[model samples]
Target: MTEIYFNLLGNSRESYRKNLILKFLEEKAGSGTGELSSKYIYYVETTATGKKIYLLRPANLNKGMDFTVHLKDVQFRLIGPFKDRPTHSEIIQDLILKKEENNLEYEKVKPLINKLFLCQAVSDEEYRNLHFSKGIEIEGILKIIKWLFIEQDITYWNFSGRKMLYESLRINNLV
Candidate 1:
C-alpha cells in the first residue's frame, strides 16, 4: 500500500519536502531517519522490532512508470509509488481532457507541461533550477525538451537546448 500526501506551501519561498517527511515519520508515527538525494532515497519505518528502511529508486522501464505529480498552488510533486502501476497515463489523459475543455492553465499544469516535476532537485529552494536527471531517462529528457519547444514555443535558440542537454548528460556521465 502507498499513501501520498500533498503539502501546498502558502509561501513559495519556503519548502520543506525532506524535513516534512522526516517530521511526519518521527512525530506522527515514530522516530526514524530518511535519506533524500538525487540518486537514491530511503525512509525508515519504525515498529516494535525497530526500524525498517524502504528504499526508493528510479524505474528503468520502457513504459507505465509511475510519475504521478501533485499540482497545487505553485508546487509540483510526485506522491508515492504504487505496486507497479503509475499515474502517468492517467495524468496525461487528464491534461488532454483539460486542454480540450480550455481549462489547461499553463501555471497550474506547468509541472507536467515543462516536465520540471520529472527532475529531482539538488538544492534547498522551492524551485530547484538544477534538475537531477532529465526525465526518467537521459534520452527521454531531450524528447521532453523537444516537446516543450512545441508546447511552450521556445523561439530563441535552435541548438541551445540540445547543447545544454548534452552538457548535463556529460556532467552526469550518462552519455
Candidate 2:
C-alpha cells in the first residue's frame, strides 16, 4: 500500500495537534499492532475560534453509503444507514432523542467492554440498537475494529492524547 500523507494540516501556524495524531498513526501503521488492520484513521479539523471540532473518519467509504465512528469528548457514536431514504439527516436528532429517552451516557456504556479480550467499547448486542437505518443491527461494521483491541494493541490514548488533539476529553478520564 502507498503511504498516504494528506494535505492534512492545511495552513495552520502550528498544526501540532494534527501532526501529533498523524505521526502517531503513521508509527502504528508502519510497525505496530495497528499495522495489521486494513483501516487507518482519517481526520477533519474545523478551527472555529474556541470551539475546534475534530472528526476522525475512516478512508474506506461504504459500498454505497458512509460509516462513521465519531468520538466527541469520551462518547463514541457508531453511525450509518447505508444511504438516503424516506427521511434523513435527522439521524443525529434521532440519536439525541433516543439518548434522552434512555438517559444513556458514555459512563453507562464504558463498562460493557470485555477488557481481557476485545478492544471493542460495545458488545454486538449494544451496537445492535445504534443503527441509523430502519431496525437493522450493526455487525461487521464494528468488527472491523476488533483487531485493535483483540490483541490489546491500541489504547484509549489514540482517541484523545494531549497533543494528538488540542482539547480532548479522554476515555481514560471517563473510565
Query: What lDDT tens digits, residue by residue, belong to model 1 across residues 1-175?
Result: 2333323222111132333334335322213333331222333222122222232323233111112111112111356434212233433433344434443332343443233323322122322231322122222222233323222112213445324433443343222
Q: Candidate 1: which stretches are off by over 4 Å? A: 1-10, 27-86, 103-175
Pairs with steric clashes in candidate 1: none
Weakest lDDT window of 10 consecutive positions for candidate 2: 145-154
Model 2 TM-score is 0.23
lDDT at 9, model 2: 33
Residue 172 CA displacement from its true place in model 1, Å: 26
RMSD each, Å:
16.0, 15.4
> In model 1, which range of ten residues has the least summed lDDT?
63-72
lDDT of each: 0.29, 0.30
